[model samples]
Target: MKKELSAIDAKYEAQKIAFGPMYFQAVVALRELGILQFISNNRKGVSIETIIEKTEVSEYGVTLLLEAAEVLGVVEIEDEIVKITKVGFFLLKDEMTRVNINFMNDVCYLGAKSMTESIKNGKPEGLKVLGDWPTIYEGLSILPEPAKTSWFEFDHYYSDNAFPEALKIVFRKNPKMIFDVGGNTGKWSFACCKHDPNVNIKILDLPVQLKVAKANATERDLLDRIDFHPINLLDRSQEIPQGADVIWMSQFLDCFSKEQIIQILENACNASSENTTLYILEPFFDNQDYPAAHHSLVATSLYFTIMANGNSKMYRVEVMKDLAREAGFEIVETYPLIGDSYHTILECRKRA
Candidate 1:
């Protein structure tokens, strides 16, 4: 039932795959040299000679990079003048593209070389490029400068913009105490305290991350409203604290395997009273409406396998719902793809 590709089309596809790395590096070079921005500003196209004059790189390097970018549809050349194409404009200016590019180049590209071995070994073999930690989260605070910046930028770009919208939903019931599980960097906890003067937050996370989160919260004088509970979620014996009105996990569970997630959810249940509500925010790959969004999530799963954690991924919504059900929770409401954000918030409660 599949349509066969024409010989020419097949060859084109094959060449794209074979030359992907070269094309990616060419775009990186073009962007790095300021050539893309230069051509973009020109609009009417600028002479290749002018680009060579403007950048420190050799004329040979400029020509080669631009020519390759042309083939990649990132630029165009006519009458000795080069112009930034639509693709090039996105590459240069789009926030999503910029984050993705930096994340790929600085964080994942080199590490991805060990992906095959990581898959075969069921471990983060590629993570050796970053550190010796079993997972990326443990080494997050110490990852080399720009790579660390790129990694957090990529992570926050997807999660932070959705906070205001999510806050409205989270605080709809006027919960007095919110237990923010896997509360990295304290961004959510800070937002919660600022949202409601009467509200307090307890952040549960690794000691290293909690230290940074506490410092960030303290800098804003939010430490009084925020509490830190340093505990490893992997320690099956350690449990989430009780007496919270709402339990929150935002962009967190994807960092864990299914079994670990189930255990965590069960711990949440143990910490929850019958009246307590649990909120889970995640970007489920299959729940994405846009092909581009789905593509990015699928690619992110590979990052989990090769560098983040050997067992986690951007999961399907149904799979997560099933796990929650297995852990004695029932979905009371579902907010899918909230406000231009690729995240879903599942409002769940302990099943009676």
Candidate 2:
């Protein structure tokens, strides 16, 4: 898989990698200082003088960022006038891009600096930046301000859009009981309650997260239909509750190491009847058609390595398929691109 690049372009790309962090900060500075917004506001290119004056940024700051932006292709400059480029527009207006940027800036930026140490130690060394937690999930309920919001927004944006289609697939067989492993915020369970009046969802997650989900269910008057089961997936002694028509794990398994994934799946299998179906919804990086989506997943895999958990990652479709198979389940069906989302849902059942 050789990349096609001219000698000059190859050297330039190497330089871009060398100054990657600095360039990232330049983008942040431009966005935060309102330079990008100001230029975008005025469709016609604005003079350097106008940018400094209108953005209220110091001339030194304005000139420095503008020059960097020009080279970064975030903006184009001609005759001392600065204008937003297509890349800049996406930075400013694309929901996915904005969410990724904010998530990185607020939750991952500082911590990401410690990724090397995290890899070396086989632990989330970066977790210290947020708090003294063993994993990010432990502190989700108590994360300070923007970090908490950024984490959930990043989490939901990837999976929630696939909920409608996921609902159709899960309830099609008229499942009466669903076990939502890692049912953060009880979102999928709430969706299930609404979709099938009689369906009961038993949420399996940490107590801290379940507290928030339980509160949400109570507020929605669906508490009666959803039950909370506090069990840490890392604790192998805890058995998943039995008698489920369907076992649902959405964007969940990627949070654990391969060995841990198999352990958890064993728990699910022990709890499941032969007729039960297991639905796993994950956005496998290599399974995607779009390069952007693939890149995002790879970046997220690094985030998991440095921030979420040390050994987990956004596994490839084949990797997950292998994990499922190793755990005594076969992927019976696959529903891809659910609702035009990046996710691929694997419908599994016990191997015969």
Over the stretch 1-352, how does candidate 2's per-residue lDDT look in tens digits?
9989999999998998999989998999999998999999988888999998877899899989988999899999999888899999999999899999989988999898898999998898888889989999989999987999999999999998999999999888999999999998988998899889999989999999999999999999997889999999788788898899999999999999999999999888888889899999999998888999999999998899888889999988888989999999999999988897999999999887
Clashing pairs in 1: none
Poorest 10 consecutive residues of model 1 by lDDT? 50-59
Q: What's the residue-level lDDT of 97 in candidate 2?
A: 94
Cα-based lDDT at residue 268, candidate 1? 95
Evaluated at residue 155, the lDDT of candidate 1 is: 90
Positional deviation of 41 in candidate 1, in angstroms? 1.4
- Reference-based TM-score of each model: 0.97, 0.97
Query: What TM-score quantifies how close candidate 1 is to the native fold?
Result: 0.97
Candidate 1 residues lying further than 4 Å off, grouped into runs, are 1-4
Write candidate 1's Cα lDDT for 1-352 as tens digits: 9999999999999999999988998888888878788889999889989888877678899889988988888888998899888998899889989999999999998889998898898888889898889889998888997899999999999999778889999999999999999998998998999899999999999998998899899899987889999989889889888899999999999998999999999999989999899999999999988898899999999999999987889999999999999999999999998887999999999998
Please report how far candidate 2 places residue 298 from its true position, in Å.
Answer: 0.3
